[model samples]
Target: MDKKDLRIVFMGTPDFAVASLRVLVENNYNVVGVITMPDKPSGRGHKIQHSAVKQYALEQNLPILQPEKLKNENFIEELKTLRADLQIVVAFRMLPEVIWDMPRLGTFNLHASLLPQYRGAAPINWAIINGEKETGATTFFLTHEIDTGKIIAQERIPIGESDNVGKIHDELMNMGAKLVQKTVDLLLEDKVDAIPQEQFFNNEADLKSAPKIFKETCRIDWNKPVEQIYNHIRGLSPYPVAWTELYTIGEEPIAAKIYSANKIQTEGQLPVGSISTDNKTYLQIACMGGAIEVKEIQLPGKKAMKIDELLRGYKFQEGSYFK
Candidate 1:
């Protein structure tokens, strides 16, 4: 137990990961090294891309390792040279047994969800998609199973009706930074007290799992309740948004992406999944119990725009219905 001074190896690769890393650096933690994913080409040109963590690490002048394979002996040897007391993993990929077991104080992770629940790659998106009112960040020891580890500390945050994945993502990123900083303080002072997850779940059953998101999963189900539908859209908003086909509010069938909308009531002659418009002020979609006013949308082959902007080039007939 190295009280007052602890050598840590920080492992992560995304903007989310950088949040924790930044806190560690700012708080004067003894971060011996950083391990992140290898650079890969992405986007239109598919040119090589340095990860957000890599860019931050470079700016901080922290030593970094971007091994293609975690099991590579050369990489493993290099990692051993860091002689870290603890290793903290954020939003990076899974780790190998050899690597995680090397640190003296053991490897820990900063997960997006409360854990034992939503224990997968896309916690923030799934939590919103599932309509959870409260979700949070957690710190725990790393085990063979992803996101299943001994509990260290967790901080809960409220999920408002208006909160989308984009909003929650930013919230968690900031929360994770503070959590990591506090976790490091605990590590340095030898005050960390880990509790086994099994104890907490001993009496509680029916634990939920957060799974990865796919393109097909992004499809909106108009048949479901409008509240559920609204949550689904917000959960994946601004990225892999829930989409459906609608023709100019009620015209020809065209694919449209709905980013933000609110549920509202409808009157007589209103059909489920129908569109109603003033053609001047509003474009609303009828639902099972109510109608939702479209705030932001994107039609096929066009950039996302507000209702006012979408109305400029595209026209929606009054009393027309959407499928």
Candidate 2:
């Protein structure tokens, strides 16, 4: 079949998914329709916001469907009308069997992490939090279980010591986009080799999971080693930031979100969560093996600022510490 003649329906919602969809459209692939999250209210004004996919689809003048319920009879009928030979999902919601099985060529998904590992909602975040030296993207056929399908192709990338979720996300997003196009072409050419995820898992229990991160998960634990604490802060930096409670001797605890920090080896022993600051230029918190020099942070109701700027206005008196 001609690449452009194979009918395809794309499903995604976030900016991460946009890269892949853009590639397909730019390559003149037959993306007959796009399915994204329903428009919903957001922010202080509660204004309705279209998903990133929907916004891009509008720019490309592609047909869109936003079904409140995936299994709605009306939605199913409309989906069938597209008569898609293949379906591609990226950074999208879980699919029902009816929806995934409808296409003649079946559905494939682009996942942020290698299959059989980091196989859940927040793979990118978990990988960085775990202090992984490497991570990658994978394209696989869809089945009953989530992210457990047969692998079609994968592209690996290095995760530097300072790389955060944002950096890794962008890297994987572009790599995944290319893999999506590659997978589609393989389908058209009948050259794909689908390898079961089990082939790589000698011990399933040893595999790392990428469950969704929660508010409590982002809380800083100053009792941990410097390397662990550093990873915890950077892994969630710039979004759902790692937070701690800053309290003076008798003042109420203040929420402090740490965005950037570096480890400093201390000569003398210090209690965990103890704060050592000049109240002018630096703020360091003692941990298991060393202290972390906080560079950027945000206090409650205040904009994120450098340590110098925060020191100018805020004071952490002697005996103040983070809990």
Candidate 3:
């Protein structure tokens, strides 16, 4: 069937997922229905927050399915009734064989990173934290394995020196939307081949995976090199920022949220976890090899501000050490 005529069942949840979903809607593709995560409590008031995909689907008045279990007999039966010509899975959860295999055209997914590399939940965060010079997005058929489907198309984007996860996410989101359109067009025209990743051969470079992140994973490690530490802070920045607590005289322990930092010279006289500052224009903390200048930071119960702004209120003695 022609792609425009193909009945597409779109699946995904977050803003990332919405990009592709929007592309299909704007292009007038036959997006017969949508599958997204159910609304869950969010924010201080605990009011329900709907998924971005769900919101978009409602605006377009598309059919939506938010089943808690894809494996349920009734859910699977309902999915089969759509008779989707092709299934497109974006930033969504895994599908059971009963559902993913139900579509005649087979299901495909848009992953945040180059497949076989960064193949798990937090691909964008992991790529930035690892200081990768290049990363890209991929759309591939969905097989039994997670993010291991056959390759359909790929788009490479540069990761800059000052790049963080948040910046990369925006860039990729736009790129993903465009790529999705191209993929669908080619898919309908039968101009693209869906080949297993293993067909082209494989190596160590192809085995990277993305694992879930947690609070423990966001802690700053002073023992690591300054570059890695700095990347970690920025990679998780403006989100679950890499944080540490500090103790000062005549005050309660304060949390430091590092959004930006740079390497600086330190005599290493102070041990790791030590802090020394000029008390005016600079704040530097010791790392494994050198010190990282706190270019941007936020303390507990305060807004994120530059070093100079924070220094104004958080005065430290010339020799006072941080724990």
Q: Pick the candidate with the highest lDDT.
A: 2
The sequence of per-residue lDDT tens digits that candidate 1 reaches over residues 1-323 is: 44326888999988988989988888777788999999999999999999999999999999999999999999999999999889999988889889989988899999999877788889999999889999999999998877778998889999998999999999999998899888877876778998878766754456677788898888877667777888888998988898887744434677888998887754543667777776666788877667778889998889998988888788865555555
Question: Compared with the true structure, what per-residue lDDT tens digits does model 3 show for residues 37-95?
Answer: 98999999999999999999999999999998878788787888888988998888988
| Clashing residue pairs for model 3 | 120-210
Which of candidates 2 and 3 is the stronger one according to lDDT? 2
- Residue 282 local lDDT, model 2: 95
How many residue pairs of model 2 clash at the backbone?
0
Off by over 4 Å in 3: 199-201, 204-206, 249-252, 265-270, 317-323
Per residue, candidate 2 scores C-alpha lDDT tens digits across 1-323 of 99879999999999999999999999999999999999999999999999999999999999999999999999999999999999999999999999999998999999999778999999988898999999999999899999999999999999999888889999999989999999999999999989999999899997999998899999999888888999988889877789999878777998899998998776676999998888899999999889989999999999999999999998888888888
Give the CA lDDT, 0 to 100, for residue 249 in model 3.
63
Q: Estimated TM-score per prediction?
A: 0.92, 0.98, 0.92
* Model 3 residue 322 lDDT score: 43
Deviation from truth (RMSD, Å), model 3: 2.2
Rank candidates by lDDT, best first: 2, 1, 3
- List CA RMSD, all candidates: 2.3, 1.0, 2.2
Residue 180 error for model 1, in Å? 1.1
Off by over 4 Å in 1: 1-4, 202-205, 247-252, 266-269, 317-323
